[model samples]
Target: MANVYDAEKKVTVNVLNKEFDLGLMIDSYGNTGFRLNNGVFVMGPMAIFSKSVLCWNVRTVIDITPESLSAFYLLEPKLDILVIGVGNRGDKLSPQTVEYLRSKKLGFEILPSSQACSTFNFLNSEQRYVAAAIIPPTNVALNLDEEFDAGYRRQRNLRLYEE
Candidate 1:
């Protein structure tokens, strides 16, 4: 497993497709959990996520749920895959967790950051299962058009991390 570099300018992270912002992703195989930016973020159902979104109407965001993560893992088209995003914590993914994943017969790759996210995608695009780690929904983000593979949409578009 190669290490994901924190300094790289552009790297792709995925929830469904390639992403330029690392904050919007998490290491999820249906229901996997992760630590991002000092706090923990987990997903549930669209209804619940939607409620959170409605409750926080002051900001722009998306509702992602634990059910979403679990559905991703349990989806019929699932690929036997696993991704570990390592950043906030240096501890090893516990043996219990690894054992549970093994029980599910998942193939695995652990990554340090976005580089690993890209490598996993490039290697497994034909299949479906993929995951990543990230902070939470951010007000600041990279627009899809800017990094969608045709080419960069904006060259010097500097955006701040959302509050």
Candidate 2:
């Protein structure tokens, strides 16, 4: 994947890879985890942050609190939206959390992880600022054999072994 700089916006865009630009993006995802642009494999819950990809310590949707999403609020360039991927299903956020984000002038949406990934990629590719916080699916065995169109597993496996 290649990065192209949008001088007017001062943001690096991944004209080659759709999901990511200057920082990390969700290259592919399985029920258990997501693969990143740089070939890193992140198992369990993760945040596809605009500036970085993080393995969130929280294990379930119930573990996600407003503080768990503080990083989005602190983003330097100010992300326009934060898409929360609630595993295989969409979940509702607490009223307090929604209110807090609204007060900060931050927009958010809750969707299934798969749909969230698509939304993030589309919005980001259009050069709209966006980010995602996703939880790995609870049912890991559901689609264990599904494959990505890019054949990304080879390098990802190699990197896992190297680590």
Candidate 3:
């Protein structure tokens, strides 16, 4: 029988044999927030650039505004794309915010937090100037807990049967 281990899964970016020192890849994310490759866990919303990460103030998609995104706009080396992680369920940005980004000539993609993390990792691996503003998913922690509990129970049952 296969052993079941209740451990946090490691998230990785597949660079396909090319090695690059892409600083600060997102290691993991949960309902609380994100964990960086360097093992630092940041709580709440955040903004991630190629080399650094910053705490973002906005909590929900509706809270996102041009003012809230000042950090991205003022980046010296302008980002090629800005990925917006709009919490658990994907939602469209406000028209005004969309216009603001377009006026700054910043390319953008809006996705659920999980997909946003993947997209950011992929683009960053390619050495593209990419950034991400992500809101922690609302339902992830509860779902993870349920799954972990179920796995633990199954493992315990297997151990009992073996004995």
Candidate 4:
């Protein structure tokens, strides 16, 4: 798991170590999102947390250009498979980066957040890891579990990274 967190509260997981926090997140249709990290995912006034602790299957997150959107690949590698969580009513995947991803032999699967929960399970079963970085308000309301509870809760909100 990510020993160092970025200012945005993002972390990198070590698949070799099999280390991750495994948190929970859900969509409007009562679907959930999960990863190794927990607590809350708050970005620009968005925050989500479950009534209890939950876990996601995120292994690690890499730093990409512009340093955003790693949330998707965090679940799987871009060159292998992908499961996209489009916003409510369905949203557009990033055409620019997506084409580049395709050029690199990445397999893209689009699904609305409305169906993210079920789709996530399917993808996991198919061994296609994915992340829903750019989701909707429903996604925000999702309850994510923070790996480092007290430590993170007290310090995660600060904008800083250890590299």
> What lDDT does the true structure give each of the candidates?
0.34, 0.67, 0.76, 0.37
Q: Candidate 3, residues 66-157: lDDT per residue as tens digits?
A: 89887887877788999999887756679998888889888988898878888888899888999999998776533465557667777787
Q: How would you encode candidate 2's per-residue C-alpha lDDT over 11-116 as one tens digit per residue?
A: 1111224343456666766655776777787887887765567788777777778889887789778888888887766466677877877788878888877777
lDDT of 1: 0.34
Candidate 2 Cα misplacement greater than 4 A, ranges: 1-23, 140-163
Q: Give the lowest summed-lDDT range of ten residues in model 3.
A: 10-19
Question: Which candidate ranks first by TM-score, i.e. highest?
Answer: 3
Ranking by lDDT: 3, 2, 4, 1
What lDDT, from 0 to 1, does candidate 3 have?
0.76
Flag regions of model 1 displaced more than 4 Å.
1-72, 124-129, 133-163
Name model 3 segments beyond 4 Å from true. Answer: 1-20, 141-163
Tens-place lDDT digits, model 4, residues 102-147: 6545565555544544454444434433333324223332223434
lDDT of 1 by residue, 1-163 (tens): 1111123343322343333333332232121222222233343211111012111111111122232234335645555564543322232445555565566666765444343434444444444444432222211133455345324222223232231
Q: Give the TM-score of candidate 3.
A: 0.74
Task: Name the candidate, 1 or 2, with the larger TM-score value.
Answer: 2
Superior by lDDT: candidate 2 or candidate 3: 3
